[model samples]
Target: MAGIKALISLSFGGAVGLMFLMLGCALPVYDEYWPLFVLFFYVLSPIPYCVSRRVTDDTDATSNACKELAVFLTTGIVVSAFGLPVIFARVHVIAWGACALVVTGNIVIFATILGFFLVFGSSDDFSWQQW
Candidate 1:
């Protein structure tokens, strides 16, 4: 159960991380001069993540599951929310493509990290482990 939860959390985290990374790439491609708005989204991108972390407690199964679900839903909303900004910001297609690539890269990285954590975090006997 713990291993499964870790895997799920890792998957979600990776996906959200990728979304933010892509969103970052998109911010630069827009012709509109709203650096602040871009900055706002850039900053807001991590809000849910931070919140989710606070909500999640790996040691507690029930709470962890709840937090995971909350984080997953929140992440989806946050990702979709960016669409409005992209439209309003008047982002170019090329920039959008760049964002996609960045997002892809982030997702890959997130997955890797998540897998690492899943394995490391699952080991019951941490006494044998070394960072």
Candidate 2:
């Protein structure tokens, strides 16, 4: 499960990065807005590594994974919140509204990650009986 998460996260991150880079070079009007995507990419960048560690059987790996997950989610929320106004002010209405799509996607991702963490943490043996 975590491996799948890691792969998806990395793929999404890479696509976002490449898209921003291309946008920065190809579109002068959107250059300033490109940085917004760059920052968002960075905020989401740790998810792959965190999810990779998350599925490990080792205690240390699990601890680090939890920490990384917490950091990624926390930073993501903070970055998005701060960037929202800036994004709204700088981009066109249509482009700015696209942020809602971004936000909804990110929220789903974070919820999945956090739910797994919570479920694992609450269980003694990671069994369904705990639920």
Candidate 3:
């Protein structure tokens, strides 16, 4: 039941984050859809971890290297997600307000992703290994 509730909450957070991203792009004052590109980052953020998990042994206590690399890649993807809006704003590709909204969305979305992992990662019911 707790896991179900957590899943619902994470889903809600993801929706809210996407709402912010859409607003940043669709708002009348912003009128630019370039900020939607951040969605790619959001999607890419988890790939490394998923890949590494498949390549390495979870039961091995010394299997930190692959996991560390995944973490490193995830971090870079997240940072790049945050940085993209700023770069767009600096380059006048998007307004400052749009950048702020995109950044806010990035933070919320990433938090939700992490929350999903924290909440369901270890539970037998949520077998990420099958992903």
Candidate 4:
């Protein structure tokens, strides 16, 4: 099914992203675990949106305060995720090369998250809730 295929692709993307993250942190040249803090951002990024969705009612208003706040919080989390590596690099806690790799990983992981929502957040027959 399409949903199954989408799930598989998303999983692959997440795995690839995490691979990049791990490479940045665990590579002999970098050898710094400071970049691992971005994993917290990755975990926190979706919480606001999920919470808001659960607390608010779906309506045709085209805009909702709860959703907007959630988006804002999500944006902050994403920005924080991207910024942490740069901060680490600036402080010499990690190498610039590692920062670049971590940033790349963040991009891939966030894109995969967006793709998951786009694919499974629909009101169609194949909602992610089914899984």
Candidate 5:
């Protein structure tokens, strides 16, 4: 089914992104765990949106304050995820190569997250809530 296929691809993408994050932290040439802090950002990024979705009703209006605030918070979390690695690299806590790897991982992971919302954030038969 199309839903199954989308789930598989999204899972694969998330795995690949985590692999890159692990490499950035565990590679012998760049064995620094500072980049691991980005995992916190990853965990926090979706919370705002999920909370807002639960708290607000879907409306036909052009805009909604709760949803806008949720998006703002999500953007801050994502920016923090990207910025943390750069700060670590700048402070020499992690190598530039490691920062680059972490950034790439962030990109892939965020894209996968976005893809998930796009594919599942609908009032259709294939809603992710069923899982």
Candidate 6:
């Protein structure tokens, strides 16, 4: 089924994204684990939207304030994720190369997360909660 294929590809992309994140920590030239903190941003990015979906009514579907606020929060979370690496690099906690790697990983991971929402979310037919 298309869903199965989509799942496999998304999994592959996530794996590659994680591999990049690990490399930022594992590679010798810029060896440090502090950059891994971006994982928190990655994890927290979707929470607001999920909560907003539960709180707002879909039927009445006029411009909802809660959903907009959730989007604003999500944007802040994503920007923070991107900013974390730059901060680490600026503070000399991690090398620029490591920061670059982490940034790339963040992009890939975030894209995968978006893809997941597009495919498995926004549809009553497929619910990620079951997984």
| 1-131: candidate 6 lDDT, tens digit per residue | 88889999999999999999999999988889998899999899999988987887674777889999999999999999999999999999999999999999999999999999888885576678566
User: What TM-score goes with each of the models?
Assistant: 0.36, 0.35, 0.92, 0.96, 0.96, 0.93
lDDT of 5 by residue, 1-131 (tens): 99899999999999999999999999999988888889898889888988888888865667999999999999999999999999999989999999999999999999999999899988899986676
Q: Please write out the lDDT profile of model 2 over residues 30-129, one tens digit for every residue.
A: 3344334435544564455455445655654435655566577667665674466346646553254344444544444444445544545444655323
Error of 5 at 117 (Å): 0.6
Give the count of colliding residue pairs in each prediction.
Answer: 0, 0, 0, 0, 0, 0
Write out the backbone clash pairs for model 4: none
Residue 9 deviation, candidate 3, in Å? 0.4
Full candidate order by TM-score, most accurate first: 5, 4, 6, 3, 1, 2
Candidates in order have lDDT scores of 0.51, 0.50, 0.88, 0.93, 0.92, 0.91
Cα deviation of 130 in candidate 3 (Å)? 4.5
The candidate 5 region of ten consecutive residues with least summed lDDT is 53-62
Better of 1 and 4 by lDDT: 4
Poorly placed runs, candidate 1 (over 4 Å): 1-66, 73-90, 127-131
Ranking by lDDT: 4, 5, 6, 3, 1, 2
Model 4 gets an lDDT of: 0.93
Candidate 3 wrongly placed segments (more than 4 Å): 58-63
Question: What TM-score quantifies how close candidate 2 is to the native fold?
Answer: 0.35
Instruction: List pairs with backbone clashes in candidate 2.
Output: none
